[model samples]
Target: MNKALFLGLALSLLPIGCRTSNPSTTTSTGRITTGQRNQQAQPFAKGADIGWLPQMEASGYVFYNDQGVRQDCFQILKDHGINTIRLRTWVNPSSDSISGHCSKDETVAMAVRARKWGMRVMIDFHYSDSWADPGKQKKPAAWEGHDFPKLLTDVYEYTFEVMTALKAKGVTPEWVQVGNETPGGMIYPEGSTANWAQLAQLINKGYDAIKAVSPQSKVILHLDQGNNRERFRTWFDNARSHGAHYDVIGLSYYPYWLPGNPDYQLSIDDLARNMNELVERYGKEVMVVEVGGEDTKPQNTYDMLVAVQRRVKAVPNNKGLGVIYWEPEGARSWSKYPLSAWGNDGKPTKALDAFLAE
Candidate 1:
């Protein structure tokens, strides 16, 4: 979006129609015109973004840290061509009864690292303690029973607080996910209502707060079970039918989790087909927010991911923006924390390969 990019794009669009009796058709730079180049240019950036949860300080797992460190991981990921970092945030998620690894401060640091190293940032607000997905959408402890109106206030305050903190740290993210994988909905009775009207208001509450702090940042609404066409249809229809305002639609495609009637392979194909249909259906940019082939396998840790990325990228309309592998290079050393994410293996698993185009 810079002046140079603009000139490059404009100059690349010149027409050399009918070759005007020219000895050769190639441009001075020998590059095809914009129209011709775009067939393969794929101007829109492509590649899986990378993010990380700091080693859960003595939670349980022994992470693969260099010299007993964490930030080193970022440098390593950058070396591998990752240009985006998606960080998650939780609300009152941990206490003596628990401990959360992804705090607002952690997000600030991660975003700073990403931006410092020339990577874009996607700040994901889980609005819950642990994973926020379709099967489970738990209300944050802070909004345990607050009435609808009060819940709305909580959403705004929390969002603004995080955004402000990040901004003060000079780490404004390029994208912000209002809520993480809120397939069913967000917040609970107030924000998690099935009523489109209520969903819109709840989403807007968070959206308003985000814009107030960082108007330039793009807003994202995320959902899990990426392959579920009906689920997506209902969710998007409701979010849109109501007044919910969002710019990007985020999805998590875990082929193993979403089971279909026909068979596994059939389900994968159906998932891709479903995504394409939704892109055309909604006319919105899509990001495979979270995806990974299980690293439990010994052969390659994870291989299906490459195939999955291909399935999405092959779709028309450039709807398939990018992919992000969740915990691909997990800090195995941090597994000791009761709620730690990955299993103990003392090594970054095969999932990393999937992000690097395998």
Candidate 2:
């Protein structure tokens, strides 16, 4: 959902074997080579939120390479310099079948695929059967009547189960988001920002669950209105005061919606400024975890991405991890997303070239 609009109202891979054996190039004996090792050593994330790919593909959407040949959707992103994949999971969304595909099993399958492709995975737990965001964080059906304490337990148990399932499949997410976009807090009144203490406790439970199963996995506290410095400071400050622990701060930015939104109106440059300030203030790695632009103006989108990349990389001490294009695959058959980076041909538009930016 486009939160800025609502708030204003009221509110890869490799080459063939022609190769020579260079000593610096460690042999790939079922182990990562030296170059691959160095790439992993770099402390930055170039990612994409591809949670829609599986469903879209299942619905007959096809992705193609630049040459117009059929290609694996994930391969396309990997070819374009994306090193991380972000998938969102819901808690028993099956009651509403349309939303259920991103259930625990489905998300694990996607994560396994990503790991097989040598990409880092980020699990975004929406904590709801359907969409959960700053505007609405409806509790899952099973937890609707639970009090704050039980809700906390629910979060922990669900997180642990998901993590355990992923581990059993050899898919350990490098990062886990406790909630989708919780600017107003999650699970409605009981865990809303109005009750910061309970909200913090709930988040901590999810955090603890993640650590229990995968200590190396980083926990992210995500909120929308990426350009709104005041909102971020207020939310994070409240969370920290209530003892909420997290490893990364994730933000969502969309230029098309931010220009005139009363709640968060900031240009690209303004976003960069806010990001730098956020990194300096929090001393935590920051990621523009969600970003998109108008699909009609592919070139403009490309330029905007370049600008974002430069700004993020400019963060002092490289604390700015990366920028993720949210659902750039929602083009052509999935015209619902006007910000998709795919063209009518079912191939990525030129805008995706921005990922190649240095």
Candidate 3:
């Protein structure tokens, strides 16, 4: 569900090994040397989609350490073991208080800040002026009335421009999500799943633009409901059949938001199964790119977070890249979002401690 909608309705990678200068280069304790570690691919990403951080700060939201001392939000997140920061960018967004202001400029600035804090970055392109999720993927206002041909150009140009801006700042995102929670598709009638062909073209354009700017960045096609295998299969099957290009299958798994507000236990195993199956079925890496729990239930949310991370790490052959907590720092007082990991006292909830575990 879109965050904006929730406020209105009710409120809602890598691998190791390969190519070492000297495979036998080991330290005195038999641990691999720094060179070997550097050569090896990145570890599982413990990410936080802090898209609302800027807005939160702008609105005078301050964070506190466990001891109640004032602290930088990034430092608080880092203290909780988050290694990657994910940001969402909206095109031509308004300056509205809650539902806007994720413009390209803001995204680039945030990416640079994350890099300064030694956190890798992931850029999510909503391609809309505001929120883009399972419920609504409205096209940017500037793109209104454009034909399919022009829409393709819009996606490519907008994506390329944003990627280029990030590159100019020397902050290449490790992963780039072309669309946000687009199970039904993005950009509206033209790019909707109702017409797979047009949707594929739009997606490919975004992919091409990202690669053009940062060839190393992995492109992700995201969808909601990580526990529903049928939904994933049906969507990805159409994506594959229509020649949509992406390197990763991104999923959102919010047990709290499920139809019945089911317990995480009811759906955790299914979420793991779906992730593994998606990797096998699509030959692409998988990631639980968006996840959250009820801020009010700190213990339950904590346990669920741990379980989610364990399932992601259990993916076969390390194809499971990681689990990211969406807006973990977006405290309820500021965002009125119930799924955040921050307590109303301005301190992080115990749920974020899950990232500290192996």
Candidate 4:
């Protein structure tokens, strides 16, 4: 089966700144506290996409620390050396009456919680009501019959609205992904990669929207099959040719899925090689936006993460942002994700220790 088809059969899967402020205060000790204190940039992002936290918690799931004491999931992750949290937002998810639990409001709430714990945030926009990947990029219910121009407009308006809402809540995302796993492009026939012009236009519109609302936020263009260097070159080269502006190249790397084809199989070393090549070729930062390992072999997961971290950190000038586990929090009865790092005990296994290994 084709990769897209296989993905489909895998059971449906599943912004920054405005400058206008100057306020200073003086401490009672006669110390001048300037509002313009220079902020130190985060060293690197070690992140997790705990988008399922809300739903899982709703189902009475509770996370625990290494000592087995129940704790807030975000806190547990932070204690384990995670410094960033990624959340996915759907256009109009229908899985739940409350907008599928991954709606804009829900995502913002999660981001707020993550921020409170000093974790950076990355918002991924799926532009669809449900799962979207290389296999499917169905338009949202409200955007179904729109022409290409109107779809482009919708993408911009939606992106701007989300960013504006996030800013209102004092949650400016460090990174914003235009689309999720868009190897074949997004939004079906309208914005598919086969029609590079339209896809590029849509992507550019998302980039412009992010800049308009939060100038400091970096925009990322994400795609799957991270081990395939040729695909990255082809898609990005075409996107650039058509004016798709972006700061980061995000990739999803699942060793099992990526090396399925006999003609194009790639090892972890191949993935590292591709990461270096992508940085050199594009002069842009690269991140393993999503990666996971088998729940059956926790050690394998640890090794995989360690290798990925080394590869990313090896990039010259620190262009490699970091790695993010897709949904490592899906411990028992909460998720069917096979690559989760959680064991049956409802807590993270040894696989999670890799984050601390750094």
Order the numbered candidates by TM-score, best leading.
Answer: 3, 4, 2, 1
Q: Model 1 off-target regions past 4 Å?
A: 1-52, 57-71, 95-99, 129-131, 259-264, 298-301, 331-345
Model with the higher lDDT, candidate 1 or 2:
2
Best candidate, lDDT: 3
Ranking by lDDT: 3, 4, 2, 1
RMSD (Cα, Å) for all candidates, in order, is 14.8, 9.3, 8.7, 8.3
User: Which of 1 and 3 is the better model by lDDT?
Assistant: 3
The candidate with the higher TM-score, 2 or 4, is: 4
Candidate 1, after superposition: displacement of residue 165 in Å?
1.5
- Candidate 1 or 4, higher lDDT? 4
Candidate 1, position 283, lDDT: 60
Clashes of 1: 11
Global Cα lDDT for candidate 1? 0.59
Question: For model 1, what is the error of residue 198's alpha carbon versus the real structure, in angstroms, after optimal superposition?
Answer: 1.2
Q: Summing lDDT over every window of 10 consecutive residues in candidate 4, give the lowest-scoring window.
A: 15-24
- Give each model's whole-structure lDDT: 0.59, 0.76, 0.83, 0.77
Q: In model 4, which regions exceed 4 Å deviation?
A: 1-41, 96-99, 259-266
Q: Write the per-residue lDDT of candidate 1 for residues 9-33, one digit (tens) a residue.
A: 3323222100000011122221223
TM-score, candidate number 3: 0.91
lDDT score at residue 20, model 2, on the 0-100 scale? 4
- Candidate 2, position 107, lDDT: 86
